[model samples]
Target: MITHRLVRTWEVLPSGGYSTAWAELTGRRLAARGRAVGLLPEPHWVTYTLDTGDDYVTSRLRVSVDTAGGTRTVDLRNDAGRWTVDGAYRPDLDGALDCDLGLCPLTNTMPVLRHDLHRGTGGGGSGPHDFLMAWVSVPDLAVSANRQTYTPLAPDGQGVGGPRASRVRYSSGEFQSDIEFDERGLVLDYPELATALTR
Candidate 1:
């Protein structure tokens, strides 16, 4: 069976070109164990949530970094199980995942999910950096409230863990330390460490 979702996503790229993704993923009952598609692909955990009646999945992603000293990667997955993290909005962000912002579907997009985020990373000029994100099942994107320049407005959706996350722009001069996380305040992807590898 397939489950539907009103997931929330946040993608960020540092001034140095390192990308970070923060996605508040939520949906109906999902598979207990599956692969969460991301910058480097990682293992996922599926569980149930009392508030949204959805699966509160938490994934531990694998991140490899090449620093000037050497290369290292930390196994950042705690216990793979269900957790309870539902409320208004997690200011601390239950968990966060770091990845290559360029790898996010919002930048190029693929069959993983069909979307209409033509905003293109926002770098148009005199504006903020644009954000285009959509899950595979939800075609009607949650825009308007965020004033996104896209199609198929879906204003009646929640951001899974809490209130929907706002779409950020690079031009805004705002930079976040991490991206891509679960409601449990976990970090899914780590790009800062990865950038050190490329350099």
Candidate 2:
């Protein structure tokens, strides 16, 4: 299979930190590695690797964190909707299709690609679909189930000569933001969270 490489960098708006990622795509399956450093709830750095099936659902995730206190790591795997965290079965994460790494924009690409949202269209029909995510808290690696929604939005008529971009309204509880994505389903802007840094 021919492999395609993608590289992206994001600036953490709130923490003045940054994240960079390198991904390889092979026949719809994706494998990625990323690093993040931030000063939010505390000073910390993180490194992660993610693997997903052809359907764009997360299959394996490994995250490592370094803090002033110490270093810790977590490994999560999803096998046909069943999940295991750190080699232990996590019933609470059952049925989750994706993992949301805190402060990482790269994680959002899966769902957007799955739903064809990057093309400014719903997965199949018009919808604000709900998704179950294994939310990983940074600096702690605590895993939990999070219910999030993704709503496809019409383009704002801004991309005339640049790369094709799409918009989506991402909502979790009361927090909501209109995120912009590139043609490849990678995040371009994530409102108050992060923004892609062009090279």
Candidate 3:
């Protein structure tokens, strides 16, 4: 497969902060590096890899956050469906599905686009669409498995086959957020948070 490289600029919503990143995606692998500054309460940089075929089979994600408290770092990996933080395996996360990094919205796009999840038909029977994924938060720099759901939004008249945007709601214990993504599955807008400047 051909390698596709993308560069995106992001704006921290409400605050109008900014960040940028470059990503490369091949057939069954993805590698990306980004610098996030002023986009959050603190600035940070992240590098990650998603080794997947039809699903998120494994991954390695690392981040370094710079804050008033001090500089904090986290390294996490998913091996053979098991999760590890820093270098120690966490039995608690053994069954988690995918990983969510703290610093970039780009990483979130992987599972969304890769899965091509069906657009629910309607009404009470959209079926069980919730997905369990390993989530990492920059605010706390902790990793956990979280449930997330995606619903197709009203048609926006874009993309090849149909509307492109989808609503994403995720909850990890006490943390949650409603996010939006484009047809390509890259984050479109993050509400009071961040918006992608590049398509």
Q: Residues 1-199, candidate 2: write the lDDT tens digits.
A: 8987999999987767999999987877789999989987789899999999978889999999999999999999998888999889999988788999988999998888887887786453457979999999887999999999999887678752255777889999999999998888888889999988853
How much is 17 displaced in model 1, in angstroms?
0.6
Candidate lDDT values, in order:
0.24, 0.87, 0.62
- Per-residue CA lDDT of candidate 3, range 1-199, in tens? 7987878878866333665767766774667677766535544443344444344344777777676677777888877777789999888777766677655677677655555532322331333346667778865677877677654433344432236555555444565665676555567777656777777
Error of 1 at 79 (Å): 1.9
How big is the RMSD of model 1?
15.6
Assess candidate 1 and give its TM-score to the true structure.
0.24
Candidate with better lDDT, 1 vs 3: 3
Mark the 10 consecutive residues where model 1 has the least summed lDDT: 138-147
Give me the runs in candidate 2 sitting further than 4 Å from their true place.
122-124, 159-163
Model 1 has a clash total of 24
Candidates ranked by lDDT: 2, 3, 1
Q: For candidate 2, what is the total of clashing residue pairs?
A: 0
Higher-scoring candidate on TM-score, 1 or 3: 3
lDDT accuracy of residue 146 in candidate 2: 97
lDDT by residue (tens digit), candidate 1, 1-199: 4333323233322222223333332443221211122232222111111111222222332334333435433222223232112212322322321111122322221111112122222222223223322111111111111112222212233432234221211221243332222222222333442221110
| Residue pairs with backbone overlap in model 3 | 13-193
